[model samples]
Target: MQATLMIYNGTAAPDADVLRTGGVPLAPARTTWPMCGNTCGGPMQFFAHLPVDYGVLSVFVCQNDPGACDTHDPVSGANRVLLFPSAELVPVAVPEEGVTLLPAVSAITTAVVTLEPEEADEDGLPPDAYDLARGGWKWEPGELFGKQREVLGSLGGSPSCLGDDRLPECPSCSGVMEFAAHLEEGIDRRSAMNLGGDLGYVFVCRPCSQGAFLRD
Candidate 1:
């Protein structure tokens, strides 16, 4: 399988036209900043700004209270995924309270990674292609364990280590959402979006202009 691996390219201008984690989010005019719907009831933390073929996928998760808000549940009102039009987006106004943005704006670059299946697949249980490719990504051939911190996750692939039964449905149309991207914590722990040591999944229903986010 082939996947587009995201590489960290150092700090970036908040609104730069690149894949990135952290910084202020860009949204259409009159779009209000999304607030967490759980007991915390504070502004959700901005996670990533992913530009895809269809549109830009903006992600947010509740960080005001972390696990207490159930950020891992798609419909728990803890995490949100927004698919916005490619044009006329403006940076959203920052809120004065709570954890609303990441501490650093990390830019991203991409590389196409190809992986060959392992022999274990013969038993009908195949390892995640994205995980395999990422785990083997080395800054230099001589390096052991690879530079995993530089990896920001993947674009345009099926969710890693996720099950079909957990795939979320679009709230508007009641249709299964398409897998959009996979997100890691970040290259820098100080500014990373907390995922409770799990991978984040993004799903979208382009026709309905809606999306869902969860972690596993």
Candidate 2:
């Protein structure tokens, strides 16, 4: 079976929820300015806002000490991921004067491709989330899998596989960093964050406000 490519151009609408996988992350109410755990004392940069079955997952990374904070450690304080329950979801609040909550939002260009089962299992690749997603889409499993989207929130509350299981160590604290996000090419296939048509892994050291990007 051959693969087919489908594209969706995401539009930027102020004060609107981005239904796609890639877009500015919106925060829940009552949360303070997403402060960097480092010395930045400023709001972290908004990454992606993914809608999952349980709720919306908002991701943010610190841009202040980009060189120091180990962006790979979950407890590094350089990045933050917040999961808001769907039932208790609230409107995103605006930041006070002079306090910036996030950078400018950008339109997303979603790139999706259908992976036939025959093509997905090539080379005896182990059954993983990607395989499950493709299977769910082709087999028409209702509720058990639901409609599979190109950009997924997170797989089983964990980062999707990127060909390897090795987690990098923090550059600053020397601790093993945590898998933060899995970024796939969404726009122009050739121009997606230089991922080279492979999955991108985002590792973070939360306390360090540092991050590392790797492609597999």
**Can you write out model 1's per-residue Cα lDDT over 57-147, one digit (the tens) per residue?**
9999999977789988899998889999889989989899999989899999998988775655676876777888788888467777788
Relative to the true structure, candidate 2 has a C-alpha RMSD (angstroms) of 9.3
Candidate 2, residue 14: how far the Cα is off, in Å: 3.5
lDDT of 2 by residue, 1-216 (tens): 221212234445544565343333455556654677766666765555545444555666565545455444545676666655545445455344322333333344333434444433576654454434433543453466533433432332234454334566677898876665565545443223223355545566666645555445
Query: What TM-score does candidate 1 get on C-alpha atoms?
Result: 0.94
- Candidate 1 error regions (>4 Å): 117-123, 139-143
Error of 2 at 86 (Å): 2.4
* Best-matching candidate per TM-score: 1
Clashes of each: 0, 22
Against the true structure, candidate 2 reaches a TM-score of 0.50
The C-alpha TM-scores of every prediction are: 0.94, 0.50
